[model samples]
Target chain A: DQQVKQNSPSLSVQEGRISILNCDYTNSMFDYFLWYKKYPAEGPTFLISISSIKDKNEDGRFTVFLNKSAKHLSLHIVPSQPGDSAVYFCAASKRNYGQNFVFGPGTRLSVLP
Target chain B: DAGVTQSPTHLIKTRGQQVTLRCSPKSGHDTVSWYQQALGQGPQFIFQYYEEEERQRGNFPDRFSGHQFPNYSSELNVNALLLGDSALYLCASSLGEVNQPQHFGDGTRLSIL
Candidate 1:
């Protein structure tokens, strides 16, 4: 069973506009959510994360919003830049589960200049 | 400090052959996790080693196994390889517990013929 899912396989946005990526989880035990950005032939780099206790977390141009009631979360990039184009993956883990992560299928985001 | 490092950036093997991949965790980190990413799919967890013992595992079969050394480095061993095993293998390291975020390596691309 896929515990986490990213419904959109790909998305495109203008460089100066906002980009949003959504993710959903079927497991209610997951309390921590994270987003990672991956480039071709490279490992994914950590982007932003949010804890269950918080509804939102922001880091620079990246922001993550979580809604427990909906079992969903989203990553928002304001004024998206060309460098932001890559595959984005959102993962979830339960603290009691000993750090084993469940990752979504990933969304390929393209920022058009 | 160095991030997670994986050796043999690429490897090709024939069916039924056995292969081993290595990983060196980031400095001062004590946990190591392995993930497999197939074409156009998100990574799926294989297992995690901490304190030189297997702490957690995912849905992977016994064909996939791993080891953690005293220095916190890790090795993933796959036996009786199948064409379906072809994928990019990723290693991630974190400090202590599930709360800490993991940093990943560039990954080793494994192709089975």
Candidate 2:
């Protein structure tokens, strides 16, 4: 079973607009969430993360919102830029077991200039 | 200043053949985590090593094994490979192993022919 899932295989958005990516999980044990962006032939780069203790965390133009009870989380990028176009993966971790993580299929964000 | 580095940018293997993928964590980092990403799917965690010892493991089977050296470099080995083993193998490193965000390297694309 996939503990974490990103339902959208891809998302298309216009530049300078807000781009939102969503993710869901079935494991209540997960207490931390992270988002990573990957370019072709490259490893994923850390984007932003949020702890279960808080519902929202923001960094520059990126913000992550978590709904613990719903086991859902989303990442938002304001004023989407062309450089932001990439495959975004969502991952969850539970500290109970050395913070082991489960990742979801990524969503490819295509920004149209 | 160095990011995680992985070797053999790409590889082609046959069924039953063994392959070794290598990784060097970012400077000053001590923890290494391995993941496998199949096409159209999210990455699956294989395991994690800390202080030259495996600190955690995921659901992968015995065919998939790894070793970490004293310098925190790591190698992932796949034995008796199958066509299904084709995918991108990624290595990530973190500091302190506390669910801290991990830095990744450009993965090795392994194709089974």
Candidate 3:
């Protein structure tokens, strides 16, 4: 059973447009959510994260919002550039759990000029 | 300073063979986590090591084992490798502090033929 799900297999956006990626989880115990960006042939890199303590977290153009009641989270990137094209994964973990993170299937985002 | 570093960027093995992958954590990070990423899927947690001890593990099989050195580097050993074990293995390092982000290595691509 997949505890985390990213239903969108891929996404496409024009450069300079806003891109939104969605993710959902079945476990209610997850308290911290994170987003990672990965290029082909490379490991996923940390992008942004949000703790259950807050509903939202932002880093420059990337923003993540968590909705505990809905067991869902979404990542928003404004002015998506060609450099932003890659796979984005949403992961969740309960605080103090020692990094036993659960990740979504991943959404490959392609930004076209 | 160098980020998390992994060795043998690529490897190929046959069924029933054993393979070992190595990683060196970023300077000053004490916690190391391992993940496996299959094609078209997000990475999955394997286990974590801290202070030269295995702190936590996920649902992976006993065929997957690991060790951490006093210098904070880590190694992952897989015995009786199966074709299902073919994936890109990633190593990430963190401070083990509550809510700290993990820095990842490029990963070692293992192909079980």
lDDT of 2 by residue, B11-65 (tens): 9999999999999999999889999999988788899999888889998889999
Q: Model 3, stretches more than 4 Å misplaced?
A: none
Over 4 Å off, model 2: none
Instruction: Give the clashing residue pairs of candidate 1, or none.
Output: none
Clashes of each: 0, 0, 0
* TM-score for candidate 3, residues paired by index: 0.98
Winner by DockQ? 1
Alpha-carbon RMSD to native, per candidate: 0.7, 1.0, 0.9
TM-score of the B chain in each candidate versus the native B chain: 0.98, 0.97, 0.99
lDDT of 1: 0.96
Error of 1 at A7 (Å): 0.6
Candidate 3 residue pairs in backbone clash: none
For candidate 3, write residues B83-108 as lDDT tens digits.
99999999999997777788899999
Tell how far residue B38 is off in model 2, in angstroms.
0.4
CA shift of A30, model 3, Å: 0.4
Per-residue lDDT of A106 in model 3: 96
Sort by lDDT, best first: 1, 3, 2
Q: Model 1 - which docking category?
A: high
Residue A108, candidate 1: alpha-carbon lDDT: 99
